[model samples]
Target: MSGPAPLPAPYALDDVDQALVHALQIAPRADWTRIGSVLGLDAVTVARRWNRLTEAGAAWISCHPAPVLAAAGQGLLAFVEVDCANGSLLDVARALAALPHVTAVEHVSGDGDLLVTVLAPDLVALTHWVTRGLGSMPGISATRTHLASTVYTEGSRWRLRALDRGQIARLADGEPARGEVPVFPLTDLDHDLIAVLSVDGRATYRALAESSGASPDTVRRRLGRLFAAGMLQTRCEVARPLSEWPVAVVYWGRVAAGALESVSRLVTGVREVRLCAGVTGRHNLLVVAWVKSLADAQRFEVRLNERAPGLEITDRAVVLWLMKVSGHLLDERGYRIGAVPFDVRAAARTAPTER
Candidate 1:
């Protein structure tokens, strides 16, 4: 039996590109001057390289820390397995791509036809979605879901890596960071501090100090140093169930590299589309749409097919279960520092109800 195929990628990257990614993972806000200083280049050169990466669609800059906002019962981690009908491989993939919680989707070469990850607020909501919503679709032979127990990693790090020295060239006047980038060893103090922060992002320095066996002053200084060195960031995860929406659907499709922007625009144009991003393996451009019920999932699919022709479709694997999710990924020390406030602002201006 044939299995799912690799999804389309907007561009290809080289080793230097890989290195650039590594460096950025370490410091998203690192200025061109600092980057150029280390790489023996100038600010203009740093900008050009970054532009190249973005233009190629090999990378994107985003602040994705919503996972931290999710409280225990507020969200679910799900894995979906999909079965297709009548050589409709591409069609099925396109349909699933449209789902809102289907953050990661892949057309695979394996026992199952397709795999997907979904997020919702509760089990009752998820049950209604699969049984009445997605299950009603034609050609969907079967769907299974696995709910996540704990998340090992989340946010930008899951998809992006830090840029390394090889990938960067310093600006003509830029200076390198003092000393070899110090890799802070995970000390007992570090671990103790992390333990406290993991429980409460806003915990006071005094409390952290008392728990970590460090003086209050020392704790403050260490945290400051960590923040400056780009070893930490603060973020929260937020999650709501699919049933809360009036409509939900998985819109999926495969397009030529040239048509990515058009499809992305079309996909995001719809109000229901919640999350959309490319993945490392196949089944790129995974999307999730939120709506009231299954009927909405169908209507969106029809419109999507008409909007983008020639794009292949795959299976729409209804989410059944989620295995593990680590609400957030702290540094090796498991602590985050210097992160901006959770910006629910992007969607706020347009969709007042969404957060």
Candidate 2:
């Protein structure tokens, strides 16, 4: 008998996988044919690799309302810090993860036991969600909520930087044209498309048509219009454990008057800065990042101090557990399993109805 087959090689994010993810990050819905061309590989090979990635839950493509909506007061975004009763952190994290409005749940190092990022349609909905929605939960806790005034950069902007300039340029082929942010409302069809894309941003026009009951051509035009209007954004995400940067941290910062906008712009340039926004809180700025280790988290602060002296880190939280990201529930090991579609017009799409 043939010797027992040698064990399969260890799974890892090899250079090729990184390149593929990098390409997708630049052009989230780029076809395999185009991405394959950029990577100098066969389209079939690229498609096979992508299938493996998604099947293993090592990566996924998801969509959410563009941050512009939050900034323009057309949608709501807030970060909530929660202090759970003794020994309820993990349970609370899982419970919070199931809430669609709670787009992200992170157990971090701070006085607070958990940090949750919430999305809603307006202030009233957000208040109700935070007060009645969360307050009614079993875990006993006090909560502090900070609303984002400006989103300089967020998860969708973070990239692996695994590909060179030329590769990225080729991958970004036929990028959609962007115009002034539309100061208007999205139609019911837009919401339908968004709900579908939230689960799979890479869905083909035909698939979107079938799911949303719009013709492929209509889906294309509406998607273009929504994009141009800055109503939605799509992103490719790799599971954290498979990434070079595994350690996550949240930084609460304060900046000098008249410097919030400029300083935020500068800080967001750091590749590790997954999120940098101006918020209404004692610490007016919020930054979230992923690094290689706890030591690297400190190094990030050092680099920040050197690069932007005006930004003061008032508080720091080393993420102990990241239960969810971008509406996708993750296992303890940080692999995507299922998604909670973010509804653009409602408080939350998947939340249970309150009595």
Candidate 3:
């Protein structure tokens, strides 16, 4: 089994740092000069703040589609808990951490286990990750998996924009003045597709063909490849909040020794718990769920306590506000496939001479 876990220590930042983070979250691509002008700071100051913020990892600036759009068929989110054998928790975590689909990894208290978040194209890929990728890791004794159904928040885009009627109208009219800073690598074709898709996921192939300057067949082939690769997915219109069931909660807990699978079966079988995992910390298990109201949240919690008496429920989070959520944000460091070769012929589409 894995040994002791490598818990990430909390890092602190001051007010200026916080402001810089907020600005980047709102507009990742804002020019230093423009940001400085808006914030009443000089360009140099803005640049310095940007550098410091990035260096500290307090925030990241990248571009990709929102979560809902990304998870259409190609991707899914899940939380995983691992109980290590020896005290080699970090070794196991490091191994699992390097897997292609793993995103966020944390070592929690209480149970002192490892918690991880992964994104995969489909259930088959997810299953392979759990059984082959993680289960094969040395020192790892146990694991629990939870599939994420709906995301309340992630990245920098929100499900519901906080705008007035006028602003909403402006947004709907394709005139949102605000810009987002995407940090993911983007190709000219990818950029063109994203630009169009942002306005309407259901836009016709001909329309996309026009905007992207590609033949209908080419566009179709590229989109097909992207979808197959788990990159450009999600074609549905934005969904309205589940008004009938608006409760969003994450529950973290752990099971008794030698009862991992039995408890995992019981927890995963619960319909109320949309996502459940065996995590590391005071609560070695984590579950995310959405219900109709606050009453539903409480009732689920009480039921969990009753069913898993030894399962320690440590911490819980009631999502109050989600500032941003998106799946299409591009990582600016490189293109989705690789470094897109520079082509002057395609410069117009890449930089867009007009805007």
Candidate 4:
């Protein structure tokens, strides 16, 4: 097989780019006018800049079923470690990166060749994919799956911490108020709505109606219900290599079950943490972070130790390369090249047949 393409030079982001990114992280679908007002820029200017960034693949927004939704039987989430045969790590990583259920894939410096995050509709679907689908792939030697018991924080919560509280308050004032809404079981129409929004979180209601074959009124009503139920969440993600913080770090740590809640809350409060969770495994807690450099990761660990006394960081890994993140497959330069919509319906169709 041919060798992989040469690594692209790192793309640099400017100060305005960073500010806009932080703003979007706070409100992924906020109107440009509101964002501009808070940032002291013209609405059109803000829109133009965002268009440029997205067109360059430097940033994007994605929609997914919230963790609460997953917990309510919408899906299953797990972290997987894959060991590959000698000299075949890249090939295996590339293959797994292309699979729809595999949301995030990274080549790391550690015991495993790759660390992957997967989402599936149910236990049977997860089992079939892990054993038959992934197991059948060539070049992979072994796999260890750790189911996430509680997702305290995910990429959606990670922010640049660049915007001040007042600025954030001003931006929030422009958005509509969200009140507590009753939870309901997801319908087939809801699934289709999620599939459409997963690709474009800011899709218009008319466009959503067209795609899902639902009336505009029905589409708007269902979407509000989903939001009220906390079943859907939108996130703004950037090309990490092009952002102000370029380095990615993952830590597997052990904490007492009693303290998991407090510890996770503390860790998630840290500005650098991108993902934090309580998982099932030797190490019950996992923390993922983004930093300006490798040294920053070391410094963050020291702070973590100080803040969460008695927590043991069992192992840490630096992400050397990210092949996929939240279903968006990135190129060498970290620009989005393709997307695999998070559609749980596929699980039913792909399930292994019983003998």
TM-score against truth, every candidate: 0.42, 0.92, 0.47, 0.90
Ten contiguous residues with the weakest lDDT in model 2: 1-10
For candidate 1, the C-alpha RMSD (Å) to the true structure equals 17.9
lDDT of each: 0.47, 0.82, 0.49, 0.81
Model 1, runs deviating above 4 Å: 1-16, 62-67, 154-355
Please provide, for model 1 over 185-222, each residue's C-alpha lDDT reduced to its tens digit, 9 standing for 90 to 100: 43456546644554345467888788878899999877
Candidate 1's displacement at residue 288, Å, is 21
Task: Encode model 3's per-residue lDDT on 244-328: one tens digit a residue.
Answer: 3345566776677577556666666555565555544455566666566778888988887777666667677664422112221
Error of 2 at 172 (Å): 2.4
**All-Cα superposition RMSD per candidate:** 17.9, 4.4, 14.9, 3.3
Worst 10 residues of 3 by lDDT: 333-342
Give the winner by lDDT: 2
Model 2 stretches with alpha carbons more than 4 Å out:
1-10, 180-183, 344-355
The candidate scoring highest on TM-score is: 2
lDDT of 4 at 78: 88
The alpha-carbon deviation from the true structure for residue 200 of candidate 1, after best TM-score superposition, in angstroms, is 28
Candidate numbers, best lDDT first, in rank order: 2, 4, 3, 1
Write down the lDDT that model 4 would get: 0.81
User: Which pairs, if any, clash in model 4?
Assistant: none
